[model samples]
Target: MAYQLPALPYDYTALEPAISKTTLEFHHDKHHASYVSKYNAAVEGTDFDKMAIEDVIKSIAGDPSKSGLFNNAAQAWNHSFYWNSMKPGGGGMPTGALASKLNADFGSYDKFVEAFKAAGGGQFGSGWAWLVVDGGTLKVTKTGNAENPLHLGQTPLLTMDVWEHAYYLDYQNKRPDYIAEFLGKLVNWDFAAANFAAA
Candidate 1:
């Protein structure tokens, strides 16, 4: 099926003081929409036209001949997942199995936050910081550009977009502030739990 821009899980204004409606409008309506359009255009009339977006991304990843398709498809999938990673009043420590797993893997929730924020802030450029399942363990990782854990054989449990466009409108050059707010007030632990369970 052709890739399309997935609707935001909440209203544009729901993220409120952390993320302005204006930001969501541009990020989802324009930026993400562009990726979907470009991805469709790139794969039109090709064998990938009818493939799932994930399959398309995996098929073309690391192939210089299809970098354009890889970038667009990966961005499309990443943005979709990113939107579901948060909710209206979503941040704070996780509970249940996810909480236990995080504690077991990272030693404590505080440590997990430290590692997650560090990975996000340490990202050199346009990229993403991810919490992924690797070898049955939860690990923190970062990827440059449209790269994601899927390409590395890991399952992404949660992610934060470190790209400037993701926060420039609200946080400007203070990417760390954006990352902090996302962790402190915007992360969707339930969503993370769901992903973790699936993984």
Candidate 2:
């Protein structure tokens, strides 16, 4: 079956102020939908069509001939993850095992915030910033266009889409402001905690 665009868990206006309705509509309905369509087209009638999205991504990552397939597939997967990475009323400090893990790995919540925001801000261009478990340690990392932690043998716990389309309609040229809101007001700690436990 062809991969389909997943609906946002919340309403278009649910993430307002942090993520505007207009931005959500365009980002989800246009940009993300495009990636899903392209990915389906790329994988149609191919062996990848029979594999899970993650499996396809891992199998073809870094192969020059499969770059197109990888790009669309990764973006499709990334956007799906990105939507759940935030919630209507989320952000601030995390709690439970995930909070403890962040504190242990990064020294404190503030330090973890610094590292995660830095990863998102420091990304040179269209890409993603991730909180991933690498070799059993929590880490902050960034990837250039269409790449993600899965390609690096890491398990992703959370993600922030740093692509221009993700924030341009809302924050304009002020990406730092967008990143700040994403952390202070929009990030979903519950989702991260669940991913952490699973990892």
TM-score of every candidate relative to the true structure: 0.98, 0.99
Q: List the residue pairs that clash in candidate 2.
A: none
Predicted candidate 1 versus true structure: per-residue lDDT over 1-199, tens digit per residue = 5777788999999999999999999999999999999988888898899888888888779999988888889999999999989888989999999999999999999999999999999999899999999999999999999999887889998899999999999999999999999999999989989999998
lDDT of 2 by residue, 1-199 (tens): 7998999999999998999999999999999999999999988898889999999999999899999989999999999999999998898999999999899999999999999889999999899999999999999999999999897889999999999999999999899999999999999999999998898
* Candidate 1 off by > 4 Å: none
TM-score of 2: 0.99
Q: Point out the worst 10-residue segment of candidate 1 by lDDT.
A: 1-10
Worst 10 residues of 2 by lDDT: 41-50
Q: Please report the candidate that would top lDDT against the real structure.
A: 2
lDDT (CA) per prediction: 0.92, 0.94
Task: Score candidate 1 by lDDT.
Answer: 0.92
